[model samples]
Target chain A: MQTETDLVTGPAPHWHEGVSIIDAMQDVLLALIPITITGILIFGTGALLVIITCVTGAVLGEIVARRFKGEQTNLGDGTAVVTGLLLALTLPPTAWWAVVPLYTLGGFLSVAIFREAMGGLGRNRFNPALMGRVFLLFGRTTLVYLAPYLIDFNPAFTPWLEELEVVDVMAKATPLLRVVEGMELPSYSTLLAIYEGGSPAETSALAVILGIIYLIYRGRISWRIPITTVTGVFLLSLFLGQDPLFQVLSGGLLFGVGFMATDWVTRPVTDTGKIIYGLGIAVLVVFFRQFIAELWIGYGGVAFSILIMNGFVRYIDKLTARRVYGQKK
Target chain B: MAEKTFRGGIHLPYFKDLSSGKEIERVPVPEEIIIPLKQSIGAACEPTVKPGEKVEAGDIVGDSEEFVSAPLHTGLPGVVKAIEPRITGTGSKIKSVIIKVDKNFSAAKPDKARNAEEVSKEEIIKAVRKAGIVGMGGAAFPTPVKLTPPDDKKVDTVIINGCECEPFLTCDYRVMLEKPKELLQGSKFLMQTMEADKCFIAIEENKMKAVNNLRKHNTFSNIDVLALPSIYPQGSEKQLIQAILDREVPEGGLPFDVGVLVQNVGTTVAIYDAVIYDKPLTERVVTVTGPNINKPANLLTWIGSPVKNLLEKCGGIKNKPARVVMGGPMTGTALSELDAPIVKSSLGLVVMTVEDSSLDVDDFRPCVRCERCIKACPIGLYPNYLSMAMEENNVVEAEKWDAMSCIECGICSYVCMSKRPIVYLIKKAKEKIQENKSD
Candidate 1:
């Protein structure tokens, strides 16, 4: 009985697949659960503290940035939370409690400067979490220089810093860093089980794989990026005469490939472009880990490689553009 | 044989259960009908009869001298009330012949069935044109125009499209199931007219009953029943040719360029009716069903019946519909009002409830660059890049991204997580690009 005047009119395809941006973001957050739990179990309260601080900082940063821009806040989309979780997973758990503020700063930088200022969410040129981590990497020297001054200025910071040193025993040089130093490697089972050396999320390869499976099953991420990235690293490690399994399992390679490198907005949109981007990230990671690890301790090669590849996403998309149907090859 | 399908189509939830099992029944003649003079893609026909003229059933009421157009005939013997502008299902107001039907008038049956085997190609073409038959699969391209491909192009294969890949509509399925022999005969008539060597009756695997029925009734060795994968837009002319023939119709080219001609199965049945029964196209099978439809059904409807009458005949609306779409859900026209009369290309009347029509048209989010649209594009065009270009209103960028090649299947918009109106933007860009070219 409703007349046309009372009804709403839209373009064709009045129905949708019912998958919204919120749904996809929620699926990603769900996929990240296994690694977060594993990180907490392995590194205890320190990992938990880093995650809580980073997520809180990122959410607050997003709200502040949106309010500043006169835009409605979209924190319900869960993108800021995902960015915060990814940034926390990329940090060393045994770092000084000063890392709490630094990690929070990284989260703030991710949503505010890297994401919101660059046009928010999908408009960002680089992976926000990786940009945040890279910013911290660049500022690490300043942090070292100010550490003693900050300790002298605040006596309360001394006990938290000393407590971090006790936890530092469990976080030694990562397997890839040890390979660069020509030290003995952990067994493959131990590495897959709970090898603690690098960032918090890198402690359990099994956990990352579980997350990857969940993401793939949920259709949240494509297999081309993660599979090609791991394959490229394994093959490149074999070419470099390093243990391929160690190269695949060590550092933040799996976690970064599964989560950060495959960030939907920053990565290439085409399938072939994704493969090229993944391989390019792998090449850079192996090259940097092999040659640059000796220069900088705890070198975050995966983050650097992915960030570099992020820069080439537009070019990759252009170069690997699909031949439109019926067009001559 | 393995089922065939083209790449880059989405798996849609085919809500065919709403009306697929219902048998086709004829709607009672309404008191008045408004036959649009132009129903197809080509030129609109001029009114052959003046106002207040008495016209018999199957009498040509509108005709044009244009070769690309078809004549319009009235289904019920009636008095022409007026020749005035009226809104059609496409939301366009064209000059229509509004006829007040005589309640006691019933159409006289044909004298005898003509021997289809003895009918020559030229005769069949002439009969098809005279009968005002057009493609009923919703394109409404004149059958005579399609039958007469350019002399330079050799159309060696005829693909009878029965895929009916659009969700919530099964008029074609019911047609095939109810009129299997006639469909095959009509396909043969099409093959004979086109001088094509072989014919393929392509049905989606979901409609296996129609497929099996057609297969069992097929008497010609040259014709094969092919069950294709049930993917949205699988029934698209270009995609159909690609799936069955593995040959891409050249860019900006017709199916004739690839030596193929695809005709909808319903059109084939019309062809049979035109050729054998010596009848003009006055009625068609339209699926009248949706979540809001109280008694969903496939109704044999007259050409110019108001959509309101059809819905009423289907037991009326159970609740207020969110959208009343004419044709398939994917590429159908959303009717602005129930007063619009059904034209030749209307495949069905789908009344979607709020739960079924879930798109929040105003809540557009930023593109996450998910590439689901790109992967879902049947034409393999980069919809993401094209959408961006269109958003900026850059005609040159849209052209560079092959915006013109987009098929407007709405899969890109359907699969978009951001729910961007991607096809709508591409259509706007294409229109602007055409305007620029003309300027």
Candidate 2:
């Protein structure tokens, strides 16, 4: 007969659903495989190198931040890897080598500052990967200003830039940039097949849809955000007298809606809140793509729109809160 | 036909197969029986039997003048050894009557059975009160008190809750299957006593065998057998009412408020025994099964049998159980010791092994705003927000979020990816709020 000390006791529920943070994070990583492969197939070794560097930097940054906060490192959770891969997929392929340090800094700051500084994973208000991408986007002017001096100081850099063979293939204007520049648009089949001159993840809408399907099948995400986002973008673009198909297929819209905007921690929790947040991002994306793109070249409307909506998630959750059972509406 | 169901409950992996197939074997009377005087939810009963007094199996050991409380009866023919406070399955110390079982005692046959149709409504209620029967489905609320609602409230429908939706619990299902006639007769007595027009015997689709059995034995036109979806809290009173009659009991109210009354199948059977055989609440079928048990089976255990004896009847533990829960896994109380005796509400003894109860407090993560808890809550309250409020010790915020409305079904904690003990925190918050209110 065992004594009472041999028994373990806790709360009423002696069973669990067997889901863990590690499993969920691993599911996200698994879902990103198709899109990551498509990105590599379109942009070659440059995209692969960027993905590797960013993921490594994010993981290292997570360790450093945890150590600094006097907390045990949670490197096995895979959240840092997700942040890094997402940030890498949003960057232009050709610019990978030239801005390696800057993007690495972006990755580091994403985990260390945006995520860990706000008390880590689920507590962060903004999507850390988007915050990282937006950081690099804000520094675009500084890079462009230093481009001439750097070329003059190091002539080898010019030839090294030219050595990127995939650059010539994507030298043509991207579809969304064409919309901004009033250039002729490509056919819908061409866009869906292998669109170039955009971020690595933006290369194939087919790949992004495949990843979304996997996430949905794994029950890691719901259709409330992504479906509402796509519908909202399509109808709103048409309402604004724009080509809805071109708008939906171009830029980082599909990738953002699939990967970044559907982030569990940064988005609203309820179904109704997710729909409202999705539509809110759609409106801002249209406003930024059509109007704000002219003011700033290669404007990342999806990143900014998602971050802005992330701010209102608390309010959205509060407003659309479910009525208590048996309580009248 | 489409199976009836309510929204927001999880599909649990019902481990009923462990004991569902085993016939309920009668456990031999142990050397000692510790009967807690206060098994029901209301006021505690005072001990009526003195130490050294000889008692019969059907003798009343305790009684109370309170209208809400039920009397206590011993199931063993023995001498009262002592009267003291003893811990019960729920982890509360209550005044109890300890009896030493007689070595040479024979089971007494019940008196001639009375016809149910000839009994008056008042007579049925009197018999139920005399039987000291409570809601055997875990709440242990006095059945007679529930049968007697206010005059203004009209209870037209009676729901016989045979859902047994809790995982690893097959006692109720066994009762429904083996004693279908008694259950139907009990249902008739409940409907007659409550003046209800219709009675629905609700069983989850997973228990189609029991549903078919009950339907086959059922002869009354007014009694209908319903097959509901196998959701975790499908047997919960409010959800059961909503799924069957499409009536919503008002907030902070009860099934009686919505012209409905729900009685568990075990309680219904007890009502049958009470009304017909003049038997008091004594032995009940309890499922003693889990992954750690050597022999998982259902036992017809006496009311005051120690959990250790019940476990011994199941061939003892295969390994050191990580958790010994007193009821179903979803809403059961984890027992700290095996000394606590089974009471009126003890439904099952689930002995979880280390692998089954692997939830670690160290692995708890912050809420990722996943809304799984919100979606899984049958009551439709925001469990995540309520958990956050309680964590910060904000009682007002917790109250605003309807913390009191939480049924503590443990669904929020079970489905939480972060493994946060949301229901535990919510329970703490409810306690804090109640303290403030009394202040």
Candidate 3:
């Protein structure tokens, strides 16, 4: 005989909207579209190769790492994709061929060492992509050794690069580097166009702005970090008697401020905490490059500043915690 | 009028349009009714009538000497079938009297006339205790118990919570429109009983027509009909007091601690019925609605009517209902079976589709540290950290994070992007803390 006891009983709330970790990660992926396209348009097939190789390597690393840790791994969540895309975008476009192997190793270290071992996605202490970029930049003689390989390279395989009018601009010792060497800077208005040089994504400031507008419009990302942090850097540059617009639009500051500092897990979650975190990143980036060091070793100041700030996220959260309505201090 | 509101709340889609337009229909007294003796917040009542005894409408069936409890009154004239354990809406089994209707059965008359002006404060309190009116806002605390606050703490304000902020429930809204006089007069009686300085009938902006109707009853100058923002948990006792009085009822404290008292509109009508007419609480308006329900409606039902009977009256269901919620979706108790009887505190019977029960547990993920829960918390407690503390099984850390301050409104869970059950974790931590204190 069978018993009649198959009814369902649960807790108070019986409804939830269709949102999950994968959905948020997917939204971030969608917001990166314009920047990714701008990178391909600026650096031709090199940017495409860097993105595909890093994304593929990072995703595979997450799968293999989680399997080894005996933990559940959801590959379709697009977190790995976001990490890979962001890592590739922050690197110099000239590293497209030579830096692929090093960055792919960096991607594996990111997922295996920083992310999965630190408890995956939301629990990870550092931004996996940024950590991977920092690892390649400082971990070894990789950048120092590979620096000469990109300088002498020809754009023979970049069939799309031959068709663009600004092909003359796609060389080593980028525009930002020329500024660091005390060379004359480009006009402020020209920062929005393709001839501007830094990383592949940083080549077009307009593309990054368009992507940021989407994030702000969709309410997917917070505006406090990008708005305050970028302004803080610009203000500091003005105080130092430097070109403020050049400080804001040039280098990886725009890309880093707009997206990287706003990652919900690694950054402070409170409104005030986010502003403080953003201002700190701005000061560190500008201070490291302008005061402490310059040239190639200091181009990495932004990523280093962000990773260091990630360590202080919990303290910032505690300090800025909202006072419970009627509790005594 | 501008809407009054507190900070930190979410605006969920108020699906009131499903049954807001439908007038409340009555469910005829069933052939057999199951009445739970423990209807209110306190001790269980002793059985007044035994098996094989005949009883009539408005007759006392069970009486408890406990000061925190209220008496139980029989609604249908019938012979006692049996007094035994029966299932209630919360899926808990309790002792209840099973009554079979007489051949010439007549239900209790709810239309007995009332003279609100003649009722004295002492008489009103006595009548409420005799009539067995519990809070119909779903808390089910006895009205007499709620009215009797400590002497040292002065009670100066009375707020009538007409803000039915729950989704898919509209019984309170319909009552405010159909019976504004009783709501106002009953509130006046409560104000006079408690010796409060002023009265506020707070309604959400979504029910502006109800607000206008209550405002038109200009006889009571002290009773002010105010509009509140339409947000989940806006009708919560503490939140209502916070928004109107600008006073916080401290952590782990009652609204009365802030010199305020809140009563549901349905309970106000019951209070009016009990005080003026010398009647007892036997029936209430239970909003029956949902997408799966074939005909959604605000239903005036007997307190002991089975949920299945009410659903059948509303044209049964369009599809297999996966869950039957007792109150509003935000804070209602989900039932295990449809046979559970609607008790005094059961405000609505919502028939949800199988899709609600089909939610996969695998979709739940790590807390993404999105401050959506923080932004949605009405009490300002940090739910994400409470969830984290509970995840790590550190109750001390949970307390430091003000886990005890959470009101269990379920808004955090409602607005969470990662589908984390933040409210559940808070409940767990609160229960653990309480257990530790007792130990």
Candidate 4:
């Protein structure tokens, strides 16, 4: 491709080869396509409705937040959309308006507080989506326990839920919660398939596997964080005399590790740092689920590990930076 | 098979195919020349020739009593048109001797023997110094000065760098292919002067023919020809030394510190010209090729010859040059004025197109902390952090990240996925450090 060019003058090498942030965001979206399809197949139209509402809400929230700050919204870049989708994928299926409004608030708060307020895009010390989700989760927990369920006391809503014939599933705890309560778990075969015990994104392990393979092969994500995170959980399970396979396959561990914890901005860029960060997340995930779940603290699950580690990411990066080449010891 | 390699280097699209196999074309003597006195890396030379003075080719026009500086020579038999400051291709306006060509030209007569075996160490240095031979690998350090290492240092090996790792520049490759005999004789002269016993002609794996050519003609008992692992910056002195000897030149140290002397393939030929024959440094083979040019070829260009002349001789701009770099694309300076004169060490006149440079089509994106720059850096420097420190105006942080150690290779910027302009930050950081020191 040799054509006469203008007197092009700039830096040395006079060449640039790199992937844009938009390209990487699109690659991430492409990786989740198969998982989204599987979620739709497993949970019917409810999964699609929930995802669509959350994505739309996040985009709207981003625009609203940007407008408030007298800035143009970067909705075209798809970062806000991706954040919303990530939040919705991990959320249990709920009323579209119910999840969307909370997600919208979270999205707005994250962009305003965590990202822009702290520093712009690459400068943020925390992953906006997970930080936003954690903020809402803790806020809701305080509202629920301290205020003693003021909002859920609506009599009309109960009657409507009764008409829908979904009260039984809502009243009884999920299989994982019961297991934490020292009850018998589901059979191994049932655990392997989708039987409604985890988040919307984790419904199909097969789908997540396919997505992770695609993302890793395309160089959009490194295999270090995901593989090492799972290894940490499995190693802890083995030490605790638990079924390592069941501990790893069930819950949202696969989806969270394969996608969420590997978020580029939230993790370390060095190989040593990445491995340490992944292992730390695994230990925290197991600690909260196996031990903290017994106390019925429903605040965070697989996501709690990611949220907690967000604080340590900067420290881990500093601690593990590789010695610069030819640097004398 | 790939030979010895150092860690962390990039593979480049070496468009040597444009002229690697082509023989050097002897450029017709130019009508005018702008020979800069400060072309070498040491102290600037004072003009020795007066305006309107008639001078023969190989005549010294500028020199200094400064021990480190190399003298400048006239490349054509001409009358001095002017003695004034002029712009060189490297973007410097140094004192220059502008010579207008005389129709009937005569070369200076050689008083030294052509046979390399008869030359003694003192004779070699004297001839090299008189000829004003500087390193032709683009550094342009005086070659005679390098031969005399500090007495306390124990020098052994003399590595002749045949690895022209910079892409689209095959002047060194052509020299090795076309002048293997002279290169070998030049290495002998170098060893005799340096008192070095072992000789290793390090060529990259890509030029297997040059390697075989050098190997076949090498008659010295102590010399061995090796194919270096094909990688960008393989021709880098410290990296090349480390690859062969597994020695690390101490931080802020020279190759002589590690008991080795390094010289580029082109410099060796110049050494051969000066030592074996009493020829002064004047002309050098420069690769003038790119997709934008009508014809891509290597030309034996005279010193002070305008780069535009070399480009026109190849085939003037096919369309419009996308970029006209003064050296290799990786580390060369941009040429806005195509008429800038090529000085002593000018390696190539790279006339690349817009597609080759890949500019203006995309904007720089924020660094995603992908660490691709770290992976691609041959120096193992964390460009991500260095760039961050620069942005924050934190010189202290940059120092901790080893900012001074950056070699300005541009590989960090090249492989950066975010197109973060990492090297620019390093340059700024270095500038800031120097400013702080001065304050």
Q: Is candidate 2 or candidate 3 better by lDDT?
A: 2
Q: DockQ for every model, please.
A: 0.64, 0.67, 0.49, 0.51
Quote the lDDT for A249 in model 3. 83
lDDT tens digits, residue span B1-439, model 3: 4456776887778889999999877886687778888888889898899999998888888889889988887777889999999988767898998888774865445576656767788899999988998999989899998888888777899999999988888999999999998899899998999899799999999999999998988488888998888877899888888789888888777778889999999999999888878888888998989877888888888778788888888887676535778888778887877778888999898877767643333346778787778878888877888887787889999988888888888888877777777787788899999999999
TM-score, cand. 1 vs. native: 0.95
lDDT of 2 by residue, A117-158 (tens): 975877889999999888877675577676746423243655
lDDT of 4: 0.79
lDDT scores of the candidates, listed in order: 0.86, 0.86, 0.80, 0.79
- i-RMSD per candidate, Å: 1.7, 1.6, 2.8, 3.5
- Tens-digit lDDT track for model 1 on B1-439? 6566787998898889989999999988888999999898898999999999998999999999988899999988989999999988878798999999998965688879989779999989989999999989988899999889889989899999999999989999999999999999999998998899999999999999999999899889999999898888899999999899999988999898999989998899999998988899999999998787789999998999999899889888777646888997788978888888888888999888767665554567778888789888999988888877777788899898899998899999899887888888889899998999899
Query: What lDDT is reached at residue B324 by model 2?
Result: 90
Worst 10 residues of 2 chain B by lDDT: B357-366
Off by over 4 Å in 2: A95-98, A146-148, A151-172, B361-363
Write one digit per residue (lDDT tens) for candidate 2, span B1-439.
4556676999999988999999989987899999998899999999999999999989999999999999999998999999999988777787899999986888888869998779999889999999999999999999999999999999999999999989999999999889999999999998888888999999999999999998899899999998888998999999999888778888889899999999999999999999999999988999999888889888999999999998888888887746898998888988888889999999999999877775555456677767789889999988888987876789899998999888889999999877888898889999999999999
True contacts kept of each: 0.71, 0.74, 0.60, 0.67
Candidate 4 lDDT by residue in tens digits, A177-209: 767677677765665566564456656676777
The 10 consecutive residues of candidate 4 chain A with the worst lDDT sum are A163-172
